[model samples]
Target: MPTSEFDLIYRYFSSLGAGPAVDLSVGDDCAILRLEPNERLATSVDTMVEGVHFPEDMFPEDIGFRAVSVAASDLAAMGARPIGMTVALTLPEADEFWINTFSQGIAQAVSEYRLPLVGGDTTRGPLTISVQVMGALPADKALLREGAQVGDLVYVSGTLGDAAGALAFLNGEWHPEPDAAEFLLQRFHRPRARVELGRELLGKATSAIDISDGLLADAGHIAAASGVSIDIECGRVPLSSALNSHPDSESKLKWALSGGDDYELCLTLPEEVPTPEGCTRIGRVTKGQGVKVDQDIDFTAGYQHF
Candidate 1:
């Protein structure tokens, strides 16, 4: 075992973060970061717990990668560009191989997002990882959840339900074809934050939220925040081939509606504005409150952390 916590940090987590956005990194009590002129900082945190958030036996590297990616998804929702992150890791004890693999996963996400690992803490406890991501965007350009207007059209980036499908498979609800199984599994393990697409919507999207919960639930958030009702066209919800291959149509649709963890962005745009590339128009904001779907689809709940 490592002699001390500092030794563990130095050996595994220290070198994973290095970049211009960070003025001072892991060795300090606090990370010093620099922001360009006219830039506003955005920060969000997400914590993953073993056996609750993920399967206890999942690969250590996958757990690390997911911790960073899920945290960055919040920044993506606000149309911010990620610059730095701090990971507070808890473990039962120091396992050299586990630490190395986990750090490698974090390094991969850090490199892909161009974020520096700034600073965090490590302690002995039940396995848990909390990642805090910091990002920045031009002043007054964030896509907030409170900006939707009655006339705005609703759109979603990429397909939904794949992650949910993976969850179903894990729970032994259904089995998909071999190819679809792989695709769904990957979608759950490595969800993209849609950073570029979010940036593209900076001035275009009226309101935005990343789909950490099910579509209906997250959309309801925008509706509730903006004080406007959202009506979704269930037929228009996009599904991947993997999701489409599910044996039961209603079950598949339910997964898309309430299964959560998709990590895609759902936003509202002006009706006259053209839909951004890589996004699909699925609904519209209306004059009432709460979210209503077109189909008889009964599922309306999302993942809850209570």
Candidate 2:
């Protein structure tokens, strides 16, 4: 690890911020950005702690990839396109090789998402990664949790519970076939943010939220914020083939409903609008408050910091 922060930034971080939207990048005290006319800026910050968020022994590259991907999920929920991001990294003790691999992973996500690295800080401390993402959308187009109306249909993108299934494998509570294991493990490490679908849902979805805190709890957030109730049909929630293959159907369903870190979007739309291509209709918004699932199940809402 390099002893000087300036040297580390120049070598590993500066080049990641070289896109056109960034007027000032890593060398400066703060990032200077240019937002297009009629566009609104959207910013979100996420922090991942060692052991709690990820295993300490996990690959350095995966840590970097998951950090950026999870942070960008917020933008997807808001129907905003990412412009740039700043990573504030805390290191217990820097390792040159680890930093290189981690930066490679971050660079990969930055390239794929078209998000430039802007400016941030690096300091010595418990292992943690905080990423602040900036995105933009046309004025009045950003999706909000408060927009869902009564009778709106609820939807979720992609399969749920695969990531939770992966955690089960890691915890030795579940054993899966090799192919299924690979798919589930990949889901845990690399979550795909639904940026394109979110953009497509703009002006269409009445309300939206990213499923980071489990499907039920996140849906409740929308219900509470919008002053309406949401009812999800457990039978209708989509599960991956990997989850379906597992023998314990009940456990799989529980994981799908209450397990966090799915990073998929749960949205509500008017009944007249056709369901988007990749999303599955799960339930509907009602006149009451709180979230209710059709099946009788008991579990915590999702991952909680406390």
Candidate 3:
């Protein structure tokens, strides 16, 4: 007998939906949620296609975790507190082993992010995962991309280019020491979403964006939205020791500048505001348009799907 969709939900996803805000979760037509007074909901969705968003041989557990984390990153960018999430998963076949392994990852994220799995759909077709994350924010308070002003210092949370470096290692571009290889691969497999840091920045940051599309491109978003130019001191972009193990400085810098999927936060703070720990000041907002980099490196706008 084949496993039914209902069976999959009951066995794998049913228990992952319990949370403080979830009134109704899996097994219901619609999940109900409660919001605090004076709080508004912030929601965003992200889709990960089998080959397009991840490598063909990527682990199922990593895929499940990555899908949820990437979706949650949008909430982080907006300085929202995660409340719940939904997953719409499509698979070519209902492989029990694969589903079980993937569900472990989902369970892990649900626990770590404190984001309950509300409701979603499972169907037959190409393998794809679409995750929608919902967060709560104080009314009238959100870190937006349009609030950056001239002279604000630009900052980014955490190191950049580790995921891109992991890709390089996977493609056999270059080999690093065992420790570096392990670090880079782990960075790719389980990228952290800066949720707490984002919340801490709500009042201090003038403008912010998550670095999913590389620094140059994501920073360009703030510039365009805020109608200001951003000048980046390429020498100041922080790199992890693992990434620095790569022999080619130019390639590492290119990955740092143009490599999408870092999942870090890029924000602009006023000159008077103190820089937060674990974040590096990379540049400043200037009176102009678009983004300008001090280094002479070849790169494009960012990742694009067409």
Candidate 4:
């Protein structure tokens, strides 16, 4: 007997949908969510296709977690508190082992991000995962990309380029020490979304964005929206020791500048605002257009799917 979609949902995903904000979860036509009167809703969706967003051979668990994390990153950028999420999973076939393992990943993300699985769909097709995350933001305060002003200091949470370095290692571009390789690979597979830090920056940050498309490109987004130029001091960008172990200065810097998938928040704060822990001051917003890096290295404006 072949398993049905409803069976799959009941067997693996039904229990993952319990949260304070979720009035109703799986096994229903629609999930019900509640928000406080002082709160506004924030939502975003992200899609990941096999062999594009992730390697075809990547573990099912990692794929599940990555999908949720990537979608939730958008909420982090808005300084919102996660409420619930939905996953639309398309699979070539219903392999029980794969489904079980993938569900574990989703469960892990749900616990880590405090985001419950609300409702979703399953269909037969090429392997793809689309995650839609919903969050709640204070009615009077929410981060935007258009508030950066000249003289605001630019900062980024956590290290950059590790995921890009991991990609390079996977592609056989270069091989580092075993320890470095392990660290980089994990960084790529399980990039942390800066949700807490984003919430902490609520009233202090002038503008913000997550570094999904690399520092230079995402910073350009803030610049374009805020009508200012961002000047990045290449020397000040943070890099992990694992990425620094690559032994190529130019490559390291390029990855830091143009490598995507870091998922760290890039934000602008007024000079008087106290910097948060684990954040490094990288540059400043100025009167101009686009982004500028004070380095001679050559690179494109981050990853493009077109």
Q: How do the predictions measure up, each by TM-score?
A: 0.95, 0.95, 0.96, 0.97
Q: For candidate 2, give the lDDT of residue 43.
A: 94
lDDT (tens digit, per residue) of candidate 4 on 107-133: 999999999999998888999999999
Model 3 alpha-carbon drift over 4 Å, by segment: 1-3, 300-306
The per-model lDDT (C-alpha) reads 0.87, 0.88, 0.90, 0.91
Q: How good is model 4 by TM-score? A: 0.97
Tens digits of per-residue lDDT for model 3 on 1-306?
Answer: 245765975689988999999888887679999999999999999999988989889899999998999998999999999999999998898888899999999999999889999998888899999999999999989999999999999999999988888888887877999999999988888888889999999988999999998888899999999999999998999999999988889889888888888899999999999889899999999999999999787665332321
State how far residue 210 of model 4 sits from its true place (Å). Answer: 0.5
On residues 33-108, what C-alpha lDDT tens digit does candidate 2 reach at each position?
9888889999999999999898878788888888999999999999998989999899887678888888988988
- Residue range with the least summed lDDT across 10 consecutive positions in model 4: 297-306
Our model 3 lands, by Cα RMSD against the true structure, at 1.9
Off by over 4 Å in 4: 1-5, 300-306
lDDT of 1 by residue, 176-292 (tens): 888999999898988888888888889889999999888988999999999999999888999999999987888888888777888999999999998899899999999999999
User: Model 4: clashing residue pairs?
Assistant: none
